[model samples]
Target: MIERKITYQHSFIGQQFIAKLDFTSQYHSLYCARLKSLKYRCISADESGYFSLSEIMEVKVNQSCLIAGIIVCTYADRSSIVEKYISKIGILADRKQSTFYNRRKEEDFIYLEDESGRVRLDLKQYFDWENLITGLVVAVRGVMRENSVLEVIEIFYPSADPPRPLLRKGDEFICFISGIEIGNPSLDPILLNLLSNFLQGNLGNDSAEVAKNIVRFVILGNSLYKADKENSFEQKAYSDISADIVPSISKSLEFFDTFLAELAGILPVDLIPGEMDPSNSSMPQQPLNPYLFPLASRYSALRSFPNPYECKIDGIHILCTSGQNINAIMQFIDTQDPIKILELTMKWRHLAPNAPDALGCIPMQDDDPFIVEDLPNLYVVGGMPNYQKLVTEEGVHCITIPKFTSRQQVVLVNRFTMESETLSFVSVIQGMNNC
Candidate 1:
């Protein structure tokens, strides 16, 4: 059934399409998950890390004081702006230029940008510790030099006490599994059976209890593998289709529909689209066409959401995206470790800050919705090459939910404590054997 069609004539961020989303206002990211606005603050050293920086700017030129602001390079493109200044802290320029302005010689300058404007930074003494991650809001104590540079100073990161949510009397659980890859032969068969049994079929004892407590299951992305082995569109033209059977998305949907219908029969499921799915190629992908899932559609519990999904369940704030954000970040960052990058990115308050540079996201020219106004209780990235989870020192649970085709492990989070545990179906079966 076809309804009104909203057109996305342009790929830019500010483009307006009279669709389900509101482009005029503050847009949510990864597929917007609007929630109640909570109280948060950016602070300085003297005041509690809870006081706003705007309320506490006390430093003057030649006097030593602490100030807080977002870090930015003068140039728009971060790649061209070399960190050559890492070695030397040169004198500040008289007037800030949109392009590169030589302070001493070839020494690049870094600026602390805030509500007022930009102030050139001289970090020769603290260059080593300034392992400054772009987009992080931090406080620095230094002498504002006559030459316009903020001389070598001490850095301060704002801190906050983790918000504790009151849990219900009954223990609850939510499962997160990514890269479903339905109908793909590469998927582990044992994992499938274990899931079916523990989730919908008969699984006695502790397992059944776990299944019942699992209130919601989020399928991050890649529900269908577009191209799999045994399918050769190049070899099998119009005639060769008879001999060699090619993989079909329709067939994949058939498998997904059965799975969703079965799973939705027992519990609610949220499906997100990956690059391989028939959704928009850009970030903030729209929900999949419901028409494809005729069987699953029969159940009110089954629904499809956009990638980078966000929502709150029982007061727990959760945000997730199919691995695109992680992939883009790893390419720009020095390390391949996902946990390290995710931990740092959370502080920046934006999921993909380096987007439109190294990453391929729709450039939202007007306003960036990717900016995380409030931190989530749990953050998940699907389709990771491996499985990993870390309850960050800051108290946010960062998790990488892996693809089902490779690893059968799905993440299980305690609905009350927000604590996470990785569960591998094969291991569970083997453990059952021992019991």
Candidate 2:
């Protein structure tokens, strides 16, 4: 087979040299340029050893530059690129120059020799040669200068490495109430109305309050569902009647007897049997009457800004610093108001154990002081839930109020946290109505 010789001028010294080339068409169209003495240098390694030197000449084409005069050597039968040359003349005469160096070896280096008689060239330091060699091979565009030795004057490494990708943030998850079971008779109507309003998106100013009420409603509903399941007729009957008719009927009187008996052990006073006289009724039965019980008997000075008549009867306030105490309070509330007959509000504080203060004072004439502590705040009232912790930095404490019945309780519950922010509550209520 006939061997081809690749010829190019030794631009470094303005001389001509011929290489017995085994060129691959696969690498055709690559550009090349002459590199001066030390203008650009590369540190490369092969099986023999590692070395560093400047690029003397480059084969320039429209598309890419081919690094020429690279000597290839073979060991046994395996072919590889050669790093060291006994003399410059031998490199120009080598046949397998491309495959002479150990391309896999990290210590191998390729050196470019410039021919004599070329213009003297100014070059960067040896250390910068690494970047220059890579810059040329990657086809980076830069300035060129002709001196005593031909060289790449300016070079870049546009394709020397791969690019990186960007990152993004993650999403968060939250849970909400969907439904509840009603067990407590007093809480039923209020809770029903509240839920109705909530589903309708009419729970104004009371998102949290309504949430609390929903919790209470859920608890009571669960209780009633359980009672109904257990066939607890007496318990079921007590919760079945409306607030107005309940207080006036003989059946209510009997149910109250049983209820007081059931509550005798925990209650402060014995449940007393009262006469069912309509004429003596202090309050008339309204569809919304169930919601008024907590306000009338339990909450003190319970008043809305535009309307002061809002109150929750048979409500309970809970306070505690420890989760255990909070759980205890919730358990107590759950048992006492099984039907969730009371409104519940919870507040958490970092302070040592102390009694909870009234959120507001009830009017003297309308107040039922006996149940003041049991008015508005109910389950998990005074302390953070087991899952929640107190944050002392801003002296910020959390309060949760569950209105077992009234949708308005949602507004009131939120009021516990956001004192005067009427818009949030109003918007929520409006949204509920729209929904």
Highest TM-score model number: 1
Check candidate 1 and list the clashing pairs: 13-363, 13-364, 30-308, 349-372
Worst 10 residues of 2 by lDDT: 351-360
Stretches of candidate 2 off by over 4 Å are 1-181, 198-394, 403-408, 411-435
Q: In candidate 2, what are the lDDT values of residues 268-383, reduced to their tens digit?
A: 11011001111111111111122322323233211111001122222212211111222222321213321121111211111101111101111122212112121122122211
Model 1 / residue 410 / CA error / Å: 0.9
| lDDT by candidate, in order shown | 0.61, 0.23
Error of 2 at 239 (Å): 23
lDDT by residue (1-435, candidate 1, tens digit) is 111111212111211211243334332232112111111234423453432333123456687656666555443333232332432244432232222222343444567755556787788878443335344456766778878788856666544445445454445667888887876777755566678778753666677666766777788888777554422211111222333333466677787788788787777778887766666655666778789899989998787777668776646677788887776666444456887667766765567654544344554434455656556778888889777877766578888888877787888877667777877786776786899
Q: Pairing residues by index, what is the TM-score of model 2?
A: 0.18
User: What is the TM-score of each predicted model, taking all chains together?
Assistant: 0.66, 0.18
- CA error at residue 416 for candidate 1, angstroms: 1.2
Clashes of 1: 4
Question: What's model 2's lDDT at 70?
Answer: 22
